[model samples]
Target: MSVQKPADPESEWLRQARAGDTSAFDQLVKPFRRRLHTHCYRMLGSPFDADDALQETLLAAWRGLGSFEARSSPGTWLTSIATRICLRMIAKRPRRLTSGDRAAPLRSTAELGEPVEGAVWLEPLPDGELADDDDPAAILLRRESIGLGFVAMLQQLPGLQRAVLLLREVLGYSAAETADMLGTSVASANSALQRSRQTMRARTDIGEKKPVDPQGLERLLQAFVAAWESRDIAAMVELLSDDVRFTMPPLPAWFDGRAFVGQFFAERVFQTPWRLEPLRGNGQPGFACYIRQAGDDRFRPGGVVLLSFAGGRISAIDSFIDPVVCRRFGMRDEIG
Candidate 1:
């Protein structure tokens, strides 16, 4: 007697999805959501923009499913759609930039110029939002790809070059696969990758250096948290690199050098009582800051700060102080 064979899960989902089963479509695409969201964030450099692009990609996928030839896996197909959507978004919107990227550092922290309008600053992705991939290589890839420094450098590249570099180097797509996704020839994709690498090298030491030891990084972060919570500006200064940078984005002002950053912290940042809840984001150590206002006992959400390390010291402190940013990071409005 012949026995019936079980249906392939992907094939079954594809059939249901094509037949307009929204649940099936959701299930079919669930496995790729986190990676695709990360891809969008890497391409756009803003979590909000990434959210929009991912929604657009999913909508496009739903409408175009009938044309999906199944030549590649669903993930590959979704990624192609996402890449195109991001390219369009990139063309229309201004490239996101860090405060340091906008202009020279300010000499004083007396006044943080009003939040810069019409500019999109790079945003951080909460580590919790990342995929639950246990593979060592996948973890490494996410670490290298989603770091704020790397994403900022990627923003400097033209759209095609950025896409090529991400697809080929970070995502591990073959040259031919990248070309097919971007609708170009393999030679062109290779050329874009070469140019992208050159630009990235010119901007920062992205792939050349080794990461600081985890134990040391933990110690540094712990010291920073203690100093910050205790309002010990001097102690905080001790953990900064000689050329440390302090930037509070949306505020056009940034400070360079440990002396200047320390002064800013003492005079501007620690003027109010504060508490920090340690967290990680953008492949770096950070925290959610809650501030106690004058005459108020309750601590309210203040901001999110992500730190970059160099030579066992804090090299850069990128703070997002907007209430909206705080909310997006899922910090409670009141931490008391």
Candidate 2:
């Protein structure tokens, strides 16, 4: 009987993976998979798209492992690859904002407990995926990079603009470095960066360098939820500024001002057996609304709602009823 010697894990694994050892390659890539998926999600905006892109990235990595050269860290290299993949996908499917794409118009308070189809909801990232220990700056940057408004605005930019903004602003890469990674001249990279910045400035109210107060935002959300759940219309009204606006994506209708919003809740949502389950969505406060089904003890998740606040009042409300989004937000089927 011939005995085979045990292989040195790192060297042997890398060698075998480079030489087309599937299991060895899986072992090499397993540790970074979740982080890669999170990165893709931040770039792509949809969990389904992120998952597909992650798979494509791993396949590309596996096939191109021999050419990896190790000039950059494996994680950085993988990020570049994933970013390119997302850029390609986004270019092919350009996201457009139409007058009818708002989310609020399609849902009513009474429909919160009923199952609704084709409702678009923002999905939440798992808390485990957000672990960061070393640099507080990096942690905060990651959170800011994934905010819903940020992501939505990112979708509006050209593919290269999106990539440049992410690489330069979010990942802290210099123009020359990003140029090298993208195989472009530094001049072109700088041009892209300037254009990206201009586009962002014109398209989004959120600035590139502003810091987000996640805890303070959470407290405000809690207050909003408490007011809504308690059926305190006056308190809810207090939370809304005079110019507050509410919009739900994938639905065309939105309401502006306190009077319309007040009428909305009073006529539409009040006195329903509804509960808000806390969720972290788009790197901000989110709630899963479980509405009691008629004659059924089980509460179904009507939809996942995301809130945007400004000037101490709720500025926007995005209600997404897509079932896939519900699952992505970690909403349980049976709510207690």
Candidate 3:
């Protein structure tokens, strides 16, 4: 697709990149890399998968550098490549399973089943891996796009529809642009978007999300860390919404309502002494939980706990048992 030269701003970098300069390639790709990585993550629902896709996209972009025509801006071009990569990946793999897939609701610890091996649970993205907090997109990023729940809901759609919705809605691509990227007619792109929107709206509880006060959440999280470390069940209960949900993914078991959630914590979670190191996950407050077992004095890696807020209380607790997630949060096993 040889075409007109790129815009003047990109011309020099494009020239350098095409002239066998790796530095120029880095200059061309670095600015869009994080957002593209995030786009991959949202598309795949697994950070690890996203990493692979992003790497492949960068490599492809590097190899195909000279063929670039300015049909789209650099960022869009890179993202389109990443999106297509993720679509191909999704077709080759199993869809990510969330707690909603369970056949029955788990009410107690005994009902907790074994972790489903090979089940792809939606992995949380670190806030650092996301766009800047001050970016206009960051406002929507928190309550809508980057939330674990939203990402989980996106999994309901087929890869193409998911890509359509994200490109049209989240990334603000026009219908024509989206269609071009997906290699579909505009009508089909619009149709897929309409259907995906309806499905997503029905599947996601966006209404329950309130504007998060950054300062308020930080203070609340501080108290939360204290209560958790102290094993103060009452303190923890005081901060929980009456209808809170607790889900430990890959286990396919979850409990609803504050009472049951609290009971699960009191009976099972707090039985072990824990030390939580605060971290941010999916643009929300979370922690890397460490446990000191009965026979072991050294605190061992338990799992990472990601919390979601609603109505001025803790609404959801998404505890990921994946050691991969722990490493993502930069936590080590056996914290001394």
* Whole-model lDDT values for every prediction: 0.89, 0.71, 0.84
Per-residue CA lDDT of model 1 for 198-254, tens digit only, reads 999888555325777888888888899899989998899999999888888788899
lDDT of 1 at 45: 94
Candidate 3 lDDT, tens digit per residue, 1-336?
989865664667778889998887888888898889888888888888888999999999998887778678998888888889999999999888778665455677776888876647888888878866576666665447878888888888999999999999888999999998888899999999999988986774733456558788888899889998999999999999988888887788888888898898898889989999988877677899999999897998888898888888888888987777788888886788
Flag the better candidate by TM-score, 2 or 3. 3
TM-score of 2: 0.82
For each predicted model, how many residue pairs clash, with residues at least 3 apart or on different chains? 0, 8, 0
Cα lDDT of model 2 by residue, 175-245, tens digit: 88888778789999899989988887787465224333767666777788898788788888888767555
RMSD of each: 1.4, 5.1, 3.8
TM-score of 3: 0.91
Ranking by lDDT: 1, 3, 2
Q: List the residue pairs that clash in candidate 1.
A: none
Off by over 4 Å in 1: 206-208
